[model samples]
Target chain A: MSDLASKSVTPGRDASASAATGYRPSRTLPIVAEIRRQASRRRTQLALGFMVLLPLIILVAFEFGGGNGDDDSNGGGAFSSLVDLATSGGLNFALFCLAVSAGFLLVVVFALFAGDTVASEASWGSLRYLLAIPVPRARLLAVKLVVALGYAFLALFLLAGTGLLVGTLRYGWHPLGSTIAAQIPPGQGVLRLLGILAYLAVILLVVAGLAFLLSVLTDAALGAVGGAVLLWILSSILDQITALGSIRNALPTHYSDAWMGLLSTPVQTEDLAKGAISAIIYAVIFWGVAFFRFTRKDITS
Target chain B: MYKRQLQIVVATSDQAFLTPAAPATYTVAIDGQLTLPTLVGTPIASPAAIYWYVLGALLAVVLLGLAVLLLVRRARRRRRVTAVNAELAETPLVVTGLRKAYKDGFVAVEEIGFTVERGQVVGLLGPNGAGKTTTLRVLMGLTTPTAGEIHVFGHRLVPGAQILSRVGALVEGPGFLPHLTGHQNLEAYWRATGRPWEDARFDEALEIAGLGSSVHRRTKNYSHGMRQRLAIAQAMLGLPELLVLDEPTDGLDPPQIAEMRRVLQRYATDGRAVLVSSHLLAEVEQTCTHAVVVNKGRIVASGPVGDIVGESPSVTIDVTDVPAATEILTGLGVRSVTPDGATGLIVDMNGTPRAELVASLVRAGVGVDRVVPRRRLEDAFLALVGDNSRGSGDR
Candidate 1:
């Protein structure tokens, strides 16, 4: 101990020699690393697990409950009609799953993944370390955003893919009985499912963007996810108010079901185009705010 | 023939050449060297000219905005460069007039100025809420300072600055992914740093941690002391030049604390620097080569450990019949007398000689068992921050 203390405070070495060798800020927090980190979390596993399980649960219910055998063509609108045709084929069941889950289930899942990405790190007290690692703030956010979106897209695919598999085994591989088309060929039906999946991925960007914004704004993971989901629900509620007239058209959820146009014979493009455009615009705005806020945030957490 | 290479530039001032009445093309010559088309295209009508004028104006506005943005960025970069170049010598860390005020106008660190030289373990000592942590936060770029500048390795520090790669820090507390194993957490952190795996000095850090096989166990089940040790090891990763740890010994047992003291001392060797903040005086006295004492966002005293400890002119006296010894010492007009232990009495020497006090004690029939100078950092710390110690506000 005395020998250690006897050493003078001026050990001879170059000042710059202590800088850690081979560090480049741009290379920090790569997208693959971020994906691996997030993927390892239990929440991510559970979310994707639930998505795969939901369709099986629905299939089991259909098998036991027998679909309420009232074949009188009740005309319960487009959604119920789609549900009625779910057992007809694998394609129809996949479409039914997409239609049912697109509104809320997919929204919540996407919001949870994107919202929890940053806020969870903050709550865990690791964000400051990342920032101090000198991971350029913009690169950090960009990588996390990419990974979150990737996971959200995976969740969508799992839901529809599981539904198709289960439905094919339970029923059979038959053409879809769409509302407008007399019978959609199995090949065309699968193509249309892919198209609908692409559209859902695009439309859900607004939820992901809003959740990402809230995640940057708050350290509480639940608050970020729940706040975004609540705001979406509020927009959905406000979209239901017909008395609001043309103003309701500006609502984020107004064109949420626009992918239904894909089920028509000629595949109506009008509402689908409007939905894609509006969703992109809203997503850009929310993402812009998130980037602007995050770059300047103090990150006290 | 224009001698100046017949520059056919579209001059905005030549309005007549662009008039609708003007011919589609015209030729001009100067000095008979060359002939060039003065008006190369059909003249634009008024409405078309207005449209072109609007487009030109929009393009000009965009160009001007881009130029302004570039200028601002250049100015910021220039300021940083100037700050870096102005340094006389490159120290591990140098902070000047650093101040930070929260959004609600509560000033956490009012004005702090200090330097951590290489090969020195400098301790930032203060009472609770005396702005020790706040100062460290600003230095780490975790919190922006409302005023002042921080320079590391002759580079002005900013959020996500590349110069931070040279420093390792564990500010406020340890932060780790609870779900990951200790080794995995350290690996993830180092990977996030984008530094080479070999530079992480994993074997050395893990040895310091002494977690043994527990390093492979998930962090969630680990105790607080385990996490603290892991965090300190994390900071030591890459063996950065400047290590800043806040309360590095908060959760350690006595043995671990003792080990930590040696680690910090050895780490600070070879031209590396360390800055640790702790309210524990003994920890700083034992570990740090130099100390900076802060009280209420201000430096009260700062110097080598011996100098600061020497400021308190006091002595601890071991005596039989402490009451009689105290009476003798007080009657001698020393500033104050306080009990140390059962047989120890601490007397503020007040510039009075130890021999004089002892002589009086013996004359009064009080057995003077022993007399030793009070050199504990605690005495110096209290002497420096004693008056307004309780007034140190919340951070």
Candidate 2:
């Protein structure tokens, strides 16, 4: 404590020094603190619960439908639908899981994790107090963005890791031969799977940033999450319309499925590269907007 | 389906393998529904043009980011300059010609300036739309000033300014997350400050809030009064040097209000200053040592509560024989004599002294039970704020 930390109503001696010395607030909210605040909430648990249950539900559905192996689409599983890839080894099945979930379910998961982070605080009327707690306005949003993205990436990892574990146990860990590059070593195979997982994580950062930006714009947590999901759905719809020309590429959903290129014989690297670069560019833009708007916002809530 | 298209290509390829010299001109139809824009004449877009478009978009976003960064930097620079230039000596707060014109062009506060020194319990009194809340908002750095300046703890008050650590504020009303327990809300709030939890006088604040075991329960179950107390406790964390409360007693019962009054008095005892805004005039009069009266975005009167409510000509007299006193007072040529009831009357003594009225009453054998000045805070506030400055209130 400083000498000026007195109870007298009059300004303390060396008042400026006392005031300056006493209140050196940290620039960021601790990751642990943020996790505590987020983990205790119902939405976080609900999202996790849904994520854990998804693999089991898909497993049941596949068990009921696995008898239909008489279909002729078997060899095309690498570049084709997940339904064709189901009977493959654990690696292919997990990849199939990522393929299916990356469309909307994982988008919802990203929206829930990152999108609900900041806006929920604002909706609950805690944002004003956080800023008033002497957390610099920019720092408040920055801390939230970090924690939100952290959770988002963690959720993706968990989903994929869970699928990997369950698929390995249910099936056998055979080499992913067709798409695994001709006669590749076992270590390289694991590396390729990790590489694809990493690629997906990077591209999904665009959604994380988008949801976070929406979180800053709207006070309602559900609105932010739903709005991001809506935009993703809109992008997917637009992507389907070949008439959109290159304009559909501007939509956030455009590059979402670009990870499929990793399954090609020679590994079509162009689409994967474009997707990663575009995602990074879009993510940077979204986060930029978030920081700018949040710092200047009136925060009436 | 693309699969059907591929199957035709495959069958033709198999036949070509069987007959090496066979000539085949296969008609293959690709999926037409693509966004790449190459199926028809006058193609405006293509997959080849995508990289350029993405680059152009990235450039636009980068430029926007730069612009916003420059603006934020300029604001920060200006705040630093103001803080350095400020001379906030011997006062916890000082406002010099502060003005705030909201984006909607509502001049909520205009050139309203005052100093809150130590050991002062200053009441900010105003009617609806008189700008009391706006003034506090500006002072707390929650809103920016348009053309004036504010210094708290001898540093410029601006958004993200660190001097805010020395001051605690509960503006408008108590806002808390209902899902969190009162204690949890306070805990989260303190942690958000980035200050160590040890610096938080949690026990002291809890005692002040008087939530007791309810502090452990969620604030969602709290009554309006409990919420207010919790807010007060949140503001009191670390026992900040300056406390700015808006309508602190608004939701409190009489007993709670009384306890809050004592808490405020004790808060200011050790040289800490408090600025409280209240609509309740009697409460302000009873609780505050000094007052600043505002009306229509301007300060009308400010000084000690006693000075603002100084002796007025009107006096409420309680007497044993009201009619007899009224008759005598009417004959004595008082300005106006309105009978309050059977026991007393309110007399507007137009320059007549209370001593003279008492002597006259005694001469006439009317027993005067009590005599008190009618200098009420309500009257003082209404008089200071004026008659026509009411209504069209802003929310």
Candidate 3:
């Protein structure tokens, strides 16, 4: 074997043997194919449907279960402030829905997309066939990652888009206002919403990264998704401890709600900046590890 | 003059967000437009945000740089591992010095090796837990071997090697996405290989599958035999140069099994090769041109089926008088003779030419109808593997 190591990979017969005539490793398992494969699954449809339906449910709750009771009394808290300004305009209601869901709902949705992609294939026993098809392991992971993130992004967009549409229709289109001395025109409000959504996407990157890593490590999709969400909950819990102090700032969930700063008059950049940076750093590390571990795995499943 | 006017306009706009208590710091009247400003030291953008953005960009660059460096290192290592040996260049498959020891101290295959050549239908004959599936798994790059080199058409086998694209395999059992129809699953698999559809030879493979209209039904609704046949068809996609199937006839009825045997024979007749594994010695004897008998994680015997069956020094003769034939055979210099049935005799030739026995029986009063080799592959297999034919526990 050691003597065999000095030889080149193929001696003139590479093009004529082994691979089929049209096979190309780079072209295998395109992202579109993976997206199509995942999109047809009932879970994906349910997930996207739930994203749209959640906002509608929230709107129905706001309309029928009306409680304008003591909005002013619950001041000084970020969530309470959003609640007080929920009906001020369509943009405010959309912002409120985002604020309520970004913490847990969006985290779970992102985890489901990233965490279930590879593990589901393994559970179905199709992974071995794909790997033996010689879909380069790195290319497979890359395609899955791209598709997973694409679906996650689509889910986020649907949630926010549906919220905006429902909120606008229910509460007439008006300028975004809050308890603070800030007023944004309807057009400007939509632009700010885009920026907030971008920040939310970045913040959820950490969840996607963790779930993707866990997906490669396990064959059980539920375990991978549940594990990622559980770890995030643990991080959020740790972030709640004041004694942890600056250590909490290093936690990925610490900046999960930092997009709230975008609702300010001049746009409070302090927390938003910290959140984006922290999210990027954590996402890079988790996703990098996932790729490394995946390419070398024996793929027994 | 335009620069100063622009500055005053920016100042006037900045005053709109200023706190009501803030003092008027700068006031100017330009082109009949009044400019108002409050708060002298407020910056247009937060310095901290700019700092974090730069830091984030730098960190991203560093991470990507590290990732690229790692990828290059892995690629170099992979190239080194995949270097072509070239010794068995024309052979479709060659495995040497193969060994696999699982994490729990279970040794599935302890130093086993074999090869499948072009135009040959070879059977890996073994009982349950004899490491047949394990060997196939390693050869297909589904699992890593502890120590070995598998060369497919001269190139060393590695996980996701481009060389593997020429090899089609079904190890263990058929694995399909339950929600997809059989046709869709096969199409999806072929598409994932990134080969052109025209090269798949779908019609030929489907003809071999014989599924007909069932091909359109979801795989979840398929029975075990249907799934097995579909998996075999999937392995035949692109009419690959080498086909490796494990227990290909596991759940098939007798007719389906016969159909598969004919399919494999035809597949090998076209200058390609097939390596099939099964515990049924009779199936191997009927379907394969060559057999590699393995038991307890070791090769016990291997060669053409006839060669193995011929190793037994015995022949069965259909005769007009079994008692007379047996008595006459015993009188000759043979090892033993026994009556098999009403008109048959089993005789151990004991280094005697089969023609000699027939010549002697014809000269005597005994009438010989037919003479066939009594030693089937089953006998040779049992003799080669002996009493320890049962597996040593598969990993």
Candidate 4:
């Protein structure tokens, strides 16, 4: 390799010579690798901590407030109210945890996961290098989106699962009481809990999509996540306006609390179902905007 | 229609409130007649609301499908790390009539064309904002070209083109996670490619970087030069077929710069090509075999370093009699002569050879201490581009 001309880059420049560079460089950025990269971030740790601590914090607050332990409150909110059903069994307690945090805390969590993934890469000046590495630009975004959604789901599960564990240990695994439409069977409680959490996860897609869109729009990670959270806050404020009529239903945040219907004795899934649908709609639109903008973006940052 | 009568109906998940055994049935009190919308079917049972939802869902699915198809097509085109391949045996990079115009209506590069042949260390020579970066960006498929074409190894360059796998570039500067060790950063990068660790050729790149044990230390703790070296090593990974480096010697000490010079020379061997961008004509002079000089978004001149420097010939003479030397050199049909300090005069010989200048100087009784031809690519560069130094930053 001493001579600049006579020798060249070595064994051989032909494809037959160096046969292995991992299938090809045109491959997508591996999802597993992206997940690994993001899983170790400080914000990720902080988000997980908030998820785990939220349940215990609520439980301790319930104990101190003496929560009227009148015991009848253990019944569901007749499947209509959005208050804590913590007095119910472990399952309802988890639902209570989700209900309290869904509007804001969970929105922030989803935004953090989705918002920071791509924008942070741009901020770090690594996006160009990633593309230079020949990670097809589209593939890079796709993998980042997948990893972001995965993290969002993981955060939701952690909060819900932790609530279940702590609630079960503190309260008993009793059936949902009469506050619900009727007393739900103890055996169906776990299934109901999982269903409610799943719906909550679906409702969060709006936040995820909005954050991901902002992530594409800006190079600042804080701006992307903060913007998404701020958007949700505004939507929540708008939901309070009865003057908006059914028009308000078009709001992505409109169905945020629809999951409460899942706890009804017989379960009224209409509101929750509408909310899930709305989330998907918003997620698809926002994600579409993101992909469109990203592909056309010059990527100077 | 003027005065709407309100009615309420209660229903649960399964049973309506009509069932006496039902413990609950939530009510939706409609002050008016209920309504539903339909998408395409007959407007039968409460179809108004359904219409809106169905429309929204359909809209989402269609857009999602479009986005997915575009992305899948891009991803499906397998990314090859072609830098390690020998596919471009003769032609490594080709930029034909390349032009780049920013969104601001500023045309950074205008129809610049050049080709980097294998085994040649080509230098992208320009002052700041000369469109050097923009040209390289077009070549590497970073910034899309407004017009013209780029073909790497005979394959047309597109965003994320598979042909790019054959290129290793350190554009802008080194961008690494501050908290991660140099080795970890490289590891993460290589792993992100999903390539086998054995093919990374990490040891060789590290050796070229001369990072030694510091590779194990976090990048935030490394010096600026160290980071730059790490970036070089990064670009060198897998021993790319075409290495495009921007200011490869920037931030490097003289010894490291010399070492870099050697590394680039050796790296350019074996049919591999290296395209280095730099504003320093001196550095490019020693480090590159050919030079492409750009000025104000246009290529001013380009050719072998020897030819470019020869194009702007000059002579420097150290003499005891500055007045006499200046007088004799000025009389020798030279382009210009400026007294250099007290004892030397710089002469732009233009085309006159050293023997004629020596003979003329001896004939004039001007004691010539030393008559040496100045080998300055800068002189050639400035001669070609003129002295327009504004608006360009080494950034």
For candidate 1, write residues B61-106 as lDDT tens digits.
6568647955875576456544453452468888899998888988
Model 2: residue A241 alpha-carbon error in angstroms: 1.7
| Each prediction's TM-score versus the true structure | 0.82, 0.80, 0.82, 0.82
Order of candidates by lDDT, top first? 3, 1, 4, 2
Tens digit per residue, CA lDDT, model 4, A220-292: 9999999999999899899999999998999988877776676665566667657777788798889979988
Which runs in model 2 stand beyond 4 Å of their true positions?
A: A1-14, A18-22, A25-28, A64-66, A69-80, A177-186, B1-82, B85-87, B316-348, B354-372, B384-395
Error of 3 at A125 (Å): 0.6
Give the range of the ten consecutive residues with the poorest summed lDDT in model 4 chain B. B80-89
Full-model lDDT for every candidate = 0.82, 0.76, 0.83, 0.78
On DockQ, who's better, 3 or 4? 4
**Candidates in descending TM-score order:** 1, 3, 4, 2
For model 4 the local lDDT of residue B358 reads: 82
lDDT against true structure, model 1: 0.82
Ten contiguous residues minimizing lDDT sum, candidate 3 chain A: A1-10
Candidate 1 stretches with Cα past 4 Å from truth are A1-19, A67-75, B1-83, B86-89, B316-350, B362-372, B376-380, B383-395
How many backbone clashes does every candidate have?
3, 11, 0, 33
Q: What level of docking quality does candidate 4 show? A: acceptable
Which regions in candidate 3 have their CA more than 4 angstroms from the true location?
Answer: A1-15, A67-76, B1-47, B50-54, B70-82, B85-87, B314-395
Interface RMSD of each: 9.9, 5.8, 10.1, 6.4
lDDT of 4 at B301: 78
Tens-digit lDDT track of model 1 for A152-267: 99999999999999899887999878655567789988998999999899889999999999999999999999999999999999999899999988888998998888888766
Per-residue CA lDDT of candidate 2, range B152-231, in tens?
A: 76677777777787888898777776778999989977776667678787878888788889999998899988999989
